[model samples]
Target: MCRRFRELAAHPTVLSRAAAAAVALRAGVWSDAAHRFLRRCAAAGNLHACYFLGMVRFYCLGSRASGVALLARAAAGGHAAALYALAVVRFNGSGGGKADKDPHAGVALCARAAWLGHVPALRELGHCLQDGNGARRDAAAGRHLLLHAAARELAAVSSARRRGRAGEDDDGAAASRFMVEWWALTSAEKPATAAGEGGSCGAGEEDAEELRLCSHARCGRRETRRHEFRRCSVCGSANYCSRACQALDWKRAHRGQCGAARWLAAGNAY
Candidate 1:
């Protein structure tokens, strides 16, 4: 009865006499009901509501694309969190591909969110600095930000763990992981795996089979107008710097190449 009454008051044509029309959601609410409420409100074109649902989707509760697309739309419509999320979506190619990952726009949106003291945005700014993601890779600046994020995470965790804290949040796992990832990055004695070359070795290497080892034979530049060539295609079945190179390379290795190409082409999913 009260829900319907509040809804009617918030209607556009209604006088909106009530001072409190916005419904308050308590923590005990089940997931299905919350999804239903968000879905209804989002479908009604409520920008803020869509942003909320987008966060739910982004944090693994729903499909990756759906969350990002909705967040991009909401950010375009001026939702603040959505604006921050748009930056992330752009960075990850989730909303679209590299062409749509507008780094300039992402930086602007991130700055706006940072101005509002948004915690996630602060962490993101650190990430941008560390990765040179449309910005300079200033390790010092990134460390400062990761430290700030660590402090905020600790404070929130302390508050949440206090007795009678109402269980309104469960940020412990998220905070711990953030601290670990950030501290590892900030430390001068970083983990060895961070060195790209170190990741390429070992008998059980993850990329062992898929990666084609460069023979470096002749070690010549393989472009047509350059030192000269035999540039292997996807399966090493053909080497063609040009159609002309194709004939030369074919005479040298074509029969074997064709034999392998025939057997391999059928399952080249990678």
Candidate 2:
């Protein structure tokens, strides 16, 4: 199988090269011939090859700078997973370079990855947004993002469990924890009322439960005390009445700034 894969990986077609490289990497076989093939494929502009080669160089060969450069090249070509990997490196100060410790840069990268439909990036961005890490505090928006990510994670866990995949139970447990945390964060908020109705109750009561507007810039629906609106889990900075509205808001603008918010929440500024 290894010999067959090596032969296929050396094929001229880009797809063949990518597939071969992926299989070889996953199989933990890093022969000199495989490495040469990956380098050639990456040089030929195969994004997958670039990513795989980058990972091999960074993790196996201890060439951090070269690996990161390759990853950046892939990310520039719009590879979502590469972007997420870079974000993680930046967030954790890994890779042994000046660029390794830039949380602000990491957050920005994570948000971009999230916009590109990276699931882990979405979850990380949600956490950042809630904590106002690199952006402003917006608890309502943060909570919505977190819940959305958690729901998706739970679904994935369910699928993995059905397949009897190892460690799926742990993933399910984590998803459950996220749900519990979300509930704890939201349980304290009061129900919302209709617009102007709060004013009718008198000026003194207005201070107790302030009226809010929808977080989405395009959908500024006025929230009243009687309305049951969803608030953000981290900072409670915004409110949304429906999942659609929240999703729209996130896609439109929230995703870009969520990382900063999360950084702030974590008591780390950069």
Candidate 3:
């Protein structure tokens, strides 16, 4: 390998290169010394190089670019991982400007990413669809997409677990597992509006304020239109009005939703 590759290995944030290095090591692409060379190629910003580099930084190597830029670059270049990463960032408010904090914007971004062939994005897009976020509430399409996302999540989770080793630090695998479980649960949940089916419909234009959102199945009350409820554990319906209202009415209804609701919340049951 050339000296440049070796020098690149020492760079603080050469994630794309590091990813190439790891892949080369794993696939016998070349000797270890050449790994840095691959990283350099990626750092150079070639399209394919950027895509692979973005993936490596995300699924493996860490970097300094706030994670959002990496996803953006990859998504712009049509890399699936970049699209998925971008969705996660947008949803979690970790990147892609402040729009990540807006569910409506997040939904749009997720849909865009999904359309570009990202699994997590696909799943999240399903949620947006079911919830009428920047799109009409399409239950049928939501369910279908969620099912696909669920299956993919499950497979990905299994693959991640398989990659774990006794002495290995498996952050990547663990992340996959988390995604798998989340998507799995989400895939089981119901459509976003199931529980509060009639609550927001002409609940009035201004008087009706949506408020008090909760996750992990805790009970709560509604007050303002903040965010959509996650989902009923038993049913796919999303009941949001108040914690008191949730507990008072949902214990029984959730039983019906339990099978699908969790997954729907994760945006996988789409």
Q: lDDT per prediction?
A: 0.49, 0.58, 0.47
Query: Which whole-number lDDT from 0 to 100 does residue 17 have in model 1?
Result: 22
* Positional deviation of residue 12's Cα in model 2 after best superposition, in angstroms: 4.0
What does candidate 3's lDDT look like per residue over 152-181, in tens digits?
Answer: 756766776787733222222323333234
* lDDT-better candidate, 1 vs 2: 2
TM-score per candidate, chains pooled:
0.44, 0.51, 0.41
* Candidate 2 residue lDDT tens string, 51-165: 6666555533446778889889989988776787677566545544344357678779878987886666787777677777666778888888878877876787678878987
Identify the runs in model 1 with alpha carbons over 4 angstroms from their true place.
1-36, 43-48, 55-80, 166-270
The TM-score that candidate 1 achieves is: 0.44
Please give the ranking of all candidate structures by TM-score, highest first, separated by commas: 2, 1, 3
Collision count for each candidate, in order = 0, 29, 43
Output the lDDT of residue 28, model 3. 19
Candidate order, lDDT descending: 2, 1, 3
Of candidate 2, the 10-residue stretch with the lowest lDDT total is: 196-205
Candidate 1 clashing pairs, residues 3+ apart or interchain: none
